[model samples]
Target: MYSISFLIGFSLLAGFAVAASPDVETRSRRVRLSASVIALASVLLALFHLASGPEFFALSPGVLHVLDWMFTIGGVGLALVLLYFCRRIVAREWYIPVLVVLQTGLMLSAEFAEVTPEVAHPFYIDSFTVLMTLIVGVVGGLICIHAIRYMQDYHAHEKTVPNRQAAFYFMLFLFLASMFGIVFSNHLLWLFFFWEVTTLCSFWLIAYSGTDEAVRNGFRALGLNLIGGVSFAAAIAWLTFGPGLHTWELDQLIAAGSAMALIPAVLIAVAGLAKSAQLPFSSWLLGAMVAPTPVSALLHSSTMVKAGVFLLVKLSPVFYDTYAGLLLSLIGGVTFLVTSLVAVNQRNAKLVLAYSTIANLGLIVMCAGVGTAGAMWAAILLILFHAVAKALMFLAVGTTEHLIGSRDIEDMEGLVYRRPAMAAMMLVGILGMFLAPFGMLLSKYTSFQAFLSMDVMLGDGLMLATILAFGSAPTLFFWSKWMGKLVAMPRRLPPGTDPIPRDEAIALVSLTLITYVACALFPLADKVFVIPYTDYLGALGLIPVVAASIPWDNIAIMSLMLAGLFLMPLAFWLRPPRHAEVSGYLSGANVSGSASYRGAMGVERVVESRGYYLSGFIREDIMMRYGMLGAGVLIVVMVGGVAL
Candidate 1:
């Protein structure tokens, strides 16, 4: 049943500040409590839906219909509230409350209405819907909790007036609700509306800092996503007017995936790539790092990027066997390989994560494009596992930045002593990202098998598959180096730093728990969620045979990981002589009373060692131009191939 009351509760939580005193402490406590309660209720709602099955629903025509209207009207109202907030209409402080009231009324109408499914079914639940609802409610809610403490520290440090905390939290909740609407909607038009809402939400969140760079990045993000929106709109129009593709329901569109389905399918795939931030479009995501940590976590982990992949998976049946499918796979593979290479050159921790996110997404997209049951299963599992690990890493990096005032991995060397808990948690998160037995690696392994099998059977080109395997090797190299640097031993702590914040510690611990639980549950999860999706794909003729002996056994891989894990501790215990280290080939006489040395002229100079950004080899400007050109070409190939 659609619980209007639950939506009301979240809306009320967002508006709690209006009724409370202006004191900071009271507002903080109220926000935290309200966020916690809303999260708990969301979890309960998710559980209820999962247990009750998708068919349990009220057939009311009154409240439920009203809720449907409210959803539409409230969307506009929220936009207005945001406009007012941004424009500084002090007289219209009431807009947020009015928006909440309208949304509540919409929920009430939807809940009480006994409308036919054909006319309007605002409240409904299925497995897929429930999954997304859980994510929005749980992950999004926790981020809200994090923001409460994070904003306090952020403002205190920035010393800004006209604190934007209230508006920020308000939009955060709206973002969550819009994400829920996106996945839950049966109608394509409604989903598109929600899709735009998410884009708007991202725009606001990215520019929340109100800095010039923040605003620039936000505009960049907006510009790129608008491309996705246009593609989405085109796809919808094609589906609506094209032969035998009239319905907007996902099930209907999938059911109609005949030989003629390729045209719209290609359009949809284009939109997916844009939204997912695949190679050419990835600059926006990199730019998005200018926003707050919570925004980054939400974008990377739970919402925007995932929507793109979700759409691809949902429409796999339509494009799998056609040239469109092959093209999609190729695009995904290229993005995956190139971005992983680009990630190698990044010193900024968040940029590394951002590129890595794009790279992993490319892998997932390629898997979906492979159009096999095994590949689809791999993609979904990757999505779930990557979300937890990536979110953990982002939050960890955010905490580190707050503590050390830097996100550069070079500067973060020997950070463990200063914030051991965060460092340890980050290690786990990174391990989940790279090493085997973890879900991301497991998915990658499965993907490799899927690609290999696809190539052998279908006679598809193996270029992409080979590139993917080759590209992935560097992933382990860079991640291991960075993780090692994080916990690298030093003689003593660096001077001038305070202890870590309690809220940050709590956030890290919670993220770790989630990541570990998700990893631990992978085996069981494979049985429940993955097996079914895989079986569905298998039935569609995409199953791949996984070879047992290729590179090494599980034990061999595990041993390597164990070795890396123990090496740091061993190094610390041994405390090898620091003076034993020799200079590089260009070494000169020591100078400046430190690591400095005399050059050719006997001049004192510092010996600087820096990691590669490889800008010359893969310059962003060059890459961006080429990436967009490639994406555009692919778009043409896909659409034309489908039309033909």
Candidate 2:
């Protein structure tokens, strides 16, 4: 099944290249084809897994040995090819073909070899693996498709001297290939190699524009990720030498979960935290915003950050019952709360998205730390839902920026009048982040429930986490406010001043549709995937499943959404008094526009409202210093605690 999936993915990439050759056209064709193939593959894979029994494939030792060599050699070959291309490919387009070929070969070999239960099947696919594979194929493919239109606009806007688009597509495909490898690989070493590939791909992608800021951000991302790479290497080495840790297979590692496993587990968690952009190391992800909007969407939603959480979830059973789990939970929870607060103060639309991405990831990490059936289920659902909604939101914001010539939230006030389709999509995306029935909210509720039930850490730790979790409500307020500001109606505009791009509208509409489908069918999703996965984890004793039946209340949530959607048009139709007399406080004279006042010299001054970036309170410099310090100290504590 895994091999077949890889073959399908590779075939799709080939079709993409054939359909879209010559930069602009190639990108559009590639995106559409990739998205279609990936989504189709994911659904088929999921259905296959759910319907078929466990012993679907049989393997031989000869096949296993051959597969091992294939993956190892293929991985090495890929690294060498990437390095060679980085040095030689002036246009950079050739890198994509090279990367796709190597990754597809390696992933297929690994999948086929692991299908057999005998010969210590190193790579096996379970429900969770299927879920991740689906995400990589579907969400990752969509981002690639969106990148087609995005990159064209990006270059056209900049009017650069030398076009490096070939290199861009190369790196983009390589990134996708690496993401697929990371999610599917069972060997920790193979996973780490793929993990590093993603980091390198991101570094190159982030620096694609080659501006000083872009280069700087790229290097910063590399430096931080290198730290993670080092930790990952160390964990692999330790696991290799440790007794009872004979294999690097993820399932074997989980089955061998002993106190002795704590050392490598802690190291792996550190790497996960860094990769996920947890506080103190979060600047790398925020700096990633310097990349193009599609890259940002890919990084934030489907690819890079997800790799980290994926690792944590894959290893949850190995560490969840230990003190290491407690530390991880605390760290994830704290990062979540802090980033959420910080997001409220951001004015740059991308930065706001970046912080929200970090916050959502923190929540995922926290769920992994909680390690209960419910929490893990929440994490998986959030992973799926957030990928769709956040990707759509980023793309929407990107299109809005392209149309309006700015990415500032203030500039986007009353954006609906300008780009109704994009604005409406953004509104849905925002609601998905905050409202009921959306996976994010549902997962968050499950996370809290899981955390409340855990007894791993006592009193103060529990209380602090609970407090932080509850305080997250305020974070939703800012999202609502910004979303409201974006969709608010403008008083007037020149007819047809802003026109939406056809390609961009297609991307936005597709993303929004996927999000809505996911939201509406969440119950079905629970029944099909989440419940089974949760039951598996519960059987493993990694989490306790709580049975609390809520009196089936979908009507209320659905009705509220319907009412809001209807009322918006109804209110607009009423047009309550266009010339209504409203006054400012302090007996100020009314200015020309609504809510303005006469200032000191009798000059009319517009009321300039701006959300606080809180630079003074959450300055990058201070936050980086303190956050790294805290994270470093925790690392020490985790290591020492494990050693003892």
Candidate 3:
């Protein structure tokens, strides 16, 4: 119980130590050691929570004492980070794993402590929370580890930008700490504070480069997330003054039921929509690509955006059969459709990733809005798979950009030959997002079923289902195109490069293993986390029970497909090609010795192939404008419905 207080203090104290340390080597060592420690603690805690039962930790004097010390220590850390940024003081770096440690201790203490009637209870430990902790610890720790060498290369490449690794690491840890706080806290005030902390951390990290675009994008992210912040604050105020029913506990708020919580729920859903980067508010996440890749990975995967969906999922009970729920489902469906299509027009790898991240988040948001057992089943799996796979991708692409000196898909042609390991890991990540037997695609299947069973009061089930079907086609198109680009044979010898750094390689490989392991063990995940959470909600009558089972025959096919996913790649790697290579026959006019052929005017020309990026038809700006307008209308109607 007191770990919450300790973590608050430790984060500030450790952040200060890392940010104010004079020696760079010392900082790097601290970051590595701290990150590793936190990751181990997170996994262990997840196991412990799974073995024991989920329980609430009550507030204690020790926690209050730690809060008092936090202000004193936190002020000093803030000053040091600011001073480091000003170039007046030398400092170092640390990563985000410490948050997991803090949360683990809180859960452990709660397991032993007895709840007293007099003490305030602010912590909620559950299987779902444990799952999120595992994600934050494993994924976030690897990201921090990857950043150690990445920032070195980043500063090497961007010589004009001043190195602020110290400030960067400080904010990074703070971000994770806030995430831990959000998932663990039951009280609305505590959740809001942590929520706002992530906003501040994201703004700082996104603007880290000091470039005009970076600064602009940073402010853009800040401005948009503040919308969510303000909405959250409004919801808190409404609950505080408007309804004198119960204390500001999330469970109590939900227990107030749909009619009483409708307005605040609508406000909070808007906040979720913005935070998850749905529709009009999505530009913030897209703009965030200007930041470093670790920041992108952190935000898109385990931390910032995840926090958004987490809140929405938490409020699913209130959303059931409500107009506000319809708003989320519709907006999410539209965002998924539009973003998936727009991704086809993207040439930059990170932009593709950004759009993909938004699209998947839209799917999760849609599922949460459905507020049924089957829907939540899909939502949680989507969260887990998306976190692991997307983080793997962002980190791999970050390394690739450094090696090839570009983040363009075209520039990555023949990457399988030039950077085989990176490309293979990336391929796994890409397929994991959309391919069968992978968690995301499987989760989508569950979501589709959830939609089919949608309540009549919500909206047209078929209409939403139709959007998903249309959206899925583009999802396949963009991912396959990018996959082809990565695995394509080079036209000529590519530029040479150094091997992937040890830290980056470890992070990439670890995530790659996690991707496969998670897919194979998904049934376990469903059993231990997803099913229990869904059952809890269903028992409370917060969500409806529906036909949620995947057919055994379909599972059999998927299991075989899963085998092929790894086996085909392994076979190709192990077996040598039996056929001889041949040069291209360009219009039946091939050069004997070269890849070129005689063309117009008898000039020798090289054959070239490029991706069909449907840019001409699918304009991003046009799509974004219309998508935002549509979602905006739904949001207005949702709010007005609550008010009336």
Clashes of 3: 0
What candidate 1 gets wrong by more than 4 Å, as runs, is 3-21, 45-130, 160-162, 258-261, 455-461, 490-493, 533-609, 615-617
Residue-wise C-alpha lDDT for candidate 3, range 1-644, written one tens digit per residue: 54444434455556667787787788888777767766776777677677555577765689745653453344335334433433311122111122222322332232223431122567877888889988887899899889989999999888999999999989888887788888888866667667767876887898899886887676677667766766666676566556444346777677676877877877888878888999889999999998989999999999999999988888887888766787788889999999999999999999999999999999988888888888888889899999999999999999999998899998888777777777788888887788737477778788888888876564467777888899989999999898888767766566776989998998998998898888888889888988788777777777788767778898888788667865554443345223223775576467753457887778877777799998789998899899989988988888888878
Among these predictions, the greatest lDDT belongs to: 3
- Can you write out model 2's per-residue Cα lDDT over 231-307, one digit (the tens) per residue? 67666656655454555666666666645566777788888988999866788998999888988988898889998
| Local distance difference test, each candidate | 0.68, 0.69, 0.78
Choose 1 or 3, whichever is better by TM-score: 3
Q: Write the per-residue lDDT of candidate 1 for residues 1-644, one digit (tens) a residue.
A: 44534654454456545234377677667666666666676667665654443442344778655655665675566446544544432342334334334433433343334431243443345554555555666666667777777777778778853478767776777777677667666656567667877877787888888876787677667667766766676766666555665554665566566465667677777778878998667888989998888899889988889888888877776665557777788778777777787787789899899989998898888887776665776788888777777887888888788888888888777666555555677787887687535477667766777776664235564665686787797677678778867766532346455666665666667767776667666566655555544454345443333332335587457546654753443343335223223444447775443356788878777654455566687676665567667866876787787777
Best-performing candidate as measured by TM-score:
3
**What's the residue-level lDDT of 283 in candidate 3?**
92
Q: If candidate 3 were superposed on the true structure by all CA atoms, what would the RMSD be?
A: 6.8
Which parts of model 3 are misplaced by more than 4 Å? 2-12, 61-119, 436-438, 570-581, 588-594
